[model samples]
Target: MSRPFADGEGKVGTWVNEFKENQDVTYACLRPVQTTVLGKTAKVYLTPFSLNDYKLEQLKHSKSLSEKNSNYMMVCQKSEPKKTCEEILIPKMKVIPSKAESTLQKLSLGVHDESNKPGHKSPSAAAILSADMESSDEDITPGVDDFSGLSPYEKKRLKNISENAKFFASLQLSEVSARLREMIKKRQPPKSKRKKPKKRENEIGCRRSMRLLKVSPSGVSLPAPPTAPMLIEDENPLLPPGPLEMIPENADDNHELFKGFLQTWAEMNKTSSKNMEEELSSLKSYKANLNGMVISEDNVHKVTKGSISSVALHPSETRILVAAGSKLGQIGLWDLTQQHKEDGTYVFYVHSQPISCLYFSPANPAHLLSLSYDGTLRCGDFSRAVFDEVYRNESRSLSSFDFLAESAATLLVGHWDGALSLVDRRTPGTSYEKLISSSMTKIRTVHIHPVQRQYFITAGLRDTHVYDARYLNPRRSQPLVSVTEHTKSIASAYFSPVTGNRVVSTCADCKLRIFDSSCVSSQMPLLTSIRHNTITGRWLTRFQAVWDPKQEDCVIVGSMAHPRRVEVFHETGKGVHSLLGEGLGSVCSINAMHPTRYVLAGGNSSGRLHIFMKPGSY
Candidate 1:
């Protein structure tokens, strides 16, 4: 959705005028605006890609207060597809001068630029980082005397003016101080000695005489030598021998010494509250990533059990069907919003192996299909996955499976053999034919054109391909365009639901790319490419790229990498948001169920099918 224009196109003017322009954008926020460390001075504005998205945000689920703590945006995806030597060479070889890549190269370079406080890394950002590093150094930690860089006056001004800033950095020192004290409190005090009290000689002598009389009365008789008090030597004054007196309770009632401590304590309290809120949000994000099962409208039918491979709803009605996996390999069906099944609830097991991919017909929601790695494609008849004897084939392993939305006779499959095949699955009770077999070297996912029945796109393990599926007859399928900007294997790709001509892809190289077919011929052309990242807990795998049905340009993608990320990228590929996923697990597969809404089903070797769905509308 990037409408890349020649730079310097918009004239700077008043805010209202800027807002009214035909092609206007909110000022490109490089970063979020923040007050200085003590909130006294304004440093710069920052646009941060807050890592607090993808959590449960349904009406019933209250808005998380932690989300407010996230103060960043404009996340950059990693390296996107680049014009490869192959793509670049083709146009030049044909004597058709390709558009000079200077512009695109510049744009791409800018997207990857670390020059300022924008994208992932920026100069100002780096400066802030250096400041942080210096502050954290054990040898240089700021204290009462560490004034290596600041003039005494500047330091005093910083303390006086920005000391009361409500934001975080303003009270960092105080917060740290409180934390230190907390740690110190965890330690027990060492034992100490006090001075022994002295007595007068006469008092000592009288005490001795009493002792002798008492001893003699007890009949223990040893005559005391002179019965006089012995002289005592002066003990070292520095060596403590007795209890030290407590300082007076009201000694120096001035509270200045504790002002900083109290400030720190307050800051620590604020930080703790913020942390608790974040923990709660993280918990919700965790649930959102794997919440594939939902109660039927009537709440009578429950979709549960082994990992759910797919969830589908009737195209026009309230009927829903769920395909799940079990140790015994079973797929279940539930009548959501309906209670008229001849059987109270229908359950069926039609495969001996775990279900790999499943889908319901766009034409008739009740009708569905299932494909397994076991080399089988099973069609469904409302209640169960009945064998479609007509379209079965076992030539190679099937990695992905789906039916074209048009009541067409085609089924698309990406195989382990690194080939993509569009099988004519119209007939179901007999042996079938190989409609079309095309290879992409390393294939990961294959799906039909949302609006163009004639074309289909294949996200290869390393590249992206657009094929003319109408040619599945061998006479029709031919390459429309091939994109190889990604240097690594592409894990997922999606054509914009609204803009069929535009495509987006994510790859192992940690990049997200956006392109339009119309501009594909422009040589160095693409709407845009983004390269920032989130979802940093796992290795990225089986991914699904999707467009927001409501806001056409909004997009979301699931990551298979550690701390699997469900990132949202804007249509222009300029904006980004990283959300939480089930766990650090590889994503097996992903697909969109509707234009505005979608369902995600993926699992790792852990046997848990992680399902993410938009909460309410679906």
Candidate 2:
């Protein structure tokens, strides 16, 4: 038997042997058409049919013989026709000639290879030459030899180039283009000579503090002694030697001058006190008096080296003495009465950190007490011309302090860690008299009640708390009155200076709250909540609302509004007066009012002091 094979016309056939019952052997032809074999579609061609009697007998018995046979083509199997044609014959590979070879052949056939010729030009250059030689006619045609060796794309590109050249020649732009090229070449900026950057010295590493560098595992080392001082004549011959000394050469004379100032300060404070009943009755007139106060050129002065953190007024009604403390721990004393003498200003470095509080002793007006974040509380004893360490807690920084007793010898101090310390000046040591722990995270301000000496209020975190001094315990002590309405941290809180009947608080939520505290044993009811801008950004000190010590019915607070001014608001949530002046440009974050005088002093972040007082009152 022959193996199956496909013809050139896409036809396939096979030959097989037939089995006959008559014992006769013959060849049988199997014809094929488009049909499915197993599962795949296949194209088939049929050969001439030759069947034996046995096959004819089998066909006669087949059931499909009754159906019509189309041109004797039998369908063996059926399947769905494919959408695409499937080639049964292998495709012949067609060889394509190389473009370079064809082009070379074409050039060899009488066309010259112009690319290598010295006199030959590019297609674009040739086009420009032809455009210069030919007339401007749309129908102008070039010789067939010009483009015979080029592709259709190259020929079209040459035609486009030639047309562009003709258009430029018609516009007479060739000379202009040449002139523009010449001008561009002539106007080209000269290359700047860049100086080679000097190789920088190795960047200096950050210098650590001398104190830190001197520390060792065994113990801290003290700083080395200073070198000998240079003579004034050697340093600057024009400068006077006496003023150049850190310690004045005429120390005795300076001491005498300071002693005389102290004596004058004591004598001014000796003025008799006014009747309390009469002053309290004149509270309305006092508010009116504040309204009429004016800020003059002499009233504003730069008193410290940095932002003022605390301010105080001397308890002298006969003279205007203002003391201010700065964030850099400098204390400035300004006397309005002697403004003509060296601007009446004296500065002293009293602490190593920001001064948190400054107060003049009511009992000894000459002694000015100052508290600092350096964990030191000192009194500027004018009589002794020294800063006496009243109390010191090296473990924690002091936030604020207030006199606890009328004698001004007992002090109540608040620590940054929300602890309280009671200090007595008469005690021999610098340690606190008593230390009380608190649950608050921080204590921003502390104020003692004027009438009720045993009661005091503290403002910090998100609440203001009032505590009874006698009942305070280290283990646990409950607040007598907790003002909890503040949604944010409270900056400062103070009791009415004379009667302690009202409490004024400033909060980070931009509100000024006044509480009625006449009945101190119970919760203080919120009397008024006035909207105010208390947001002083990181560089400025926080705004604190304080009370007019002379007027119990009004409160004084710094304002952040434009046309910068300090505001005095009544306890009933009404604006009493807005103190504005020409020299008061910045927000006065810290302010103080004289106890018995009609004087108001505001301290700004730049360490300047602005005072407003009735004409000639200061």
Residue-level lDDT tens digits of model 2 in 1-618: 333322222223331111113222221112121111101201111112221211111111111111112111111112122311112111100111233223223322211233333332223322222221221122223431243344322332233333333333344444555678788899999999999987669968787775677765566786667899867653211211111111211134456565556566555545446765464646567657867888978788888888999999887777888899998777888778874634367677677679989988878787788889888888776655667777777779899999999989789999988899988778665544788986677899999998999999999899888999999898767788777899998999999988899999999999999999999998899999999999999999999999887688888989989999999888989998899989788899999988767788999999899999889784
Tell me each candidate's RMSD, in Å, in order.
46.9, 24.2
Per-model TM against the reference: 0.42, 0.61
Cα deviation of 280 in candidate 2 (Å)? Answer: 2.4
Q: Which candidate ranks first by lDDT, i.e. highest?
A: 2
Error of 2 at 613 (Å): 1.1
Candidate 2 residue runs with Cα over 4 Å from true position? 1-263, 266-271, 277-284, 339-343
Tens digits of per-residue lDDT for model 1, 1-618: 121111111112122223225322332321122112212122111212221331111111111111111111111111123432223222322331112122122222332332321122222322221121111111211341333344332222222211112122322444556677777888858677786878766663434564646566556876756776665853211212212222212224444532322232223211111221121223234334435433222322323344444434323312223344432245554332233432323445555455655666655444556666556666554333233432444656666765665774667777766666656655444434554556466666676666675566777767677776555544334466777788876766766664466777776666677777643323323677777442333432244465544344566665544555455667676544454443424443333333222443333323333444445532
Return the clash pairs for model 2, or none.
Answer: 12-45
